[model samples]
Target chain A: MSTIEDVTREFEQIIPSDTAAGQSVQERIIQMLEELRFEDRDVFGIRLAMEEALVNAIKHGNQMDPTKTVRIACQIGQQRVRIEIEDQGSGFHPEDLPDPTADENLERPCGRGIMLMRAFMTSITFNPTGNCVVMTKDRSEPEPETPAGESA
Target chain B: MSQGNRRLDLEEVNGVTVARFTDKKILDESNIQIIGNQLFSLVDDDHRQKVVLDFTNVEYLSSAALGKLITMDKKVKAAGAKLRLCSIRSDIKEVFKITRLDKLFNIFDNRDKALEGF
Candidate 1:
């Protein structure tokens, strides 16, 4: 995995607080990920995580305020892909979030995005303001060898 | 929500409502609202049970979409119906497993297997 010191390429963009704009930003990031030759599975997970973060930034963080903007920064390296997303809103503590996995919370729909981000990425952290999220996926592990009887 | 702006292709088979969303990337909030309304309406308004969401074409899902699924599942359960998911790719299935939603809802490898229990 590439350490923070070994960033090969970096890009950043500020998207409007519109869902359409968010999709465009995600597509641009996906293009970069493809150029990096990330594994299919990794690309899928990264895309989902990026969407979750971007959605949270646009909806929950900016509250769909057209005047607000979502800032996204990407760092692509030989061994890792890192992204940071920030929104302009009153930040909320990530620790205060309800456990979506808990039986009592399972039925609620909105709390699972953060959990999904954590699940897909190798590392996830929220800024003190709670308005920014940084996530990374490491490519350190070798692809699992397909079993003899199974086709990949 | 309206007939003109349908985002999902819903099919009724053997009393099971199979909702197939075609967007390869379901990352936006607009998509979430559409999917949430479509899935929840199946239970709350249409009163149809045994809903199956086929993800054969969906390559990715945002967290907001995941939340909508949870809401849809709860609505189905409250209506005394079952919601099953099928054809989720292995890469995306990891999200369900990580959130422990694989335990909360019935997931099948394909639509036929998902329809079996319903």
Candidate 2:
């Protein structure tokens, strides 16, 4: 039921502005992927999603304060895997958030995280607490690595 | 946590080449090649067993970036190296899981573990 028995696979993380923290976030995520035995593209898909969420949480939500922290969690269920990201800053007005897909926002430097989150994740929700967000994914495909007798 | 305005950084850490980017949503289809090609060059050697992509700076991911990772993995594998991720933010991680990518790449807690895992 748990992927991170050693505390590396499944757990929570707090990030500072230092990009080094970003590296840790990336490592933990990919580690979970390898543990779960996903397909190649599936791996990329997950990384892409995770990256966008973290960047926004750190850069925009916290405004790179380095004082504010971004919190993360990963868990595995029988049929699906779940993740949550929370920030210390006051949440943005969802209505005020720009639409990245709109033609006017197309060339904007940033604002695509929400768009990609909707496209890639099976489900995404903003918490009423305004401090938390949750996302989920299902495991139904073949894995990229097949141990000795397993078929692709 | 300081604002870099979501710029992607590429460099070497723990002797492993990494692409550090801050993206907020699904990437536009056009940006894929630029990011993918750059990341590919870093992890494109068989001896180079690891590539860490830090997402703490990003808020979202588009499928375009997803395709880039898959293709980049292809090139890295052909070269005999490995591709991985670290410190993923949760909201975006959900997208990957929904896409079945949660089961993909070798994700770790940090670069040290990622490098040590190999």
Maximum-lDDT candidate: 1
DockQ of each: 0.77, 0.09
TM-scores of chain A in all candidate models: 0.90, 0.77
**Could you tell me the C-alpha RMSD of candidate 2 in Å?**
13.7
Q: Best by TM-score, which number?
A: 1
lDDT of each: 0.83, 0.63
Quote the lDDT for A96 in model 1. 91
Model 1, range A67-91, lDDT digits (tens) per residue? 9999998888888888989999998
Q: Which stretches of candidate 1 lie over 4 Å from their true place?
A: A1-3, A140-150, B1-3
RMSD of model 1 against the true structure: 2.6
lDDT of 1 by residue, B1-118 (tens): 6634776789999888889987887767766677778778888888986789999988878767787887787787778988889999887788788888899878999999988857
Pairs with steric clashes in candidate 1: none
Q: What DockQ does candidate 1 have relative to the true complex?
A: 0.77
* lDDT of candidate 2 over B7-113, digit per residue (tens): 45766776676667745443533355556555665654324566777666766556557667667666777787777787777656765555555565677766566
Candidate 2 C-alpha lDDT tens digits along A32-83? 6777676545565566667667766776678778678888888755456577
The per-residue C-alpha lDDT of model 1 at residue A57 equals 87
Worst 10 residues of 2 chain B by lDDT: B1-10
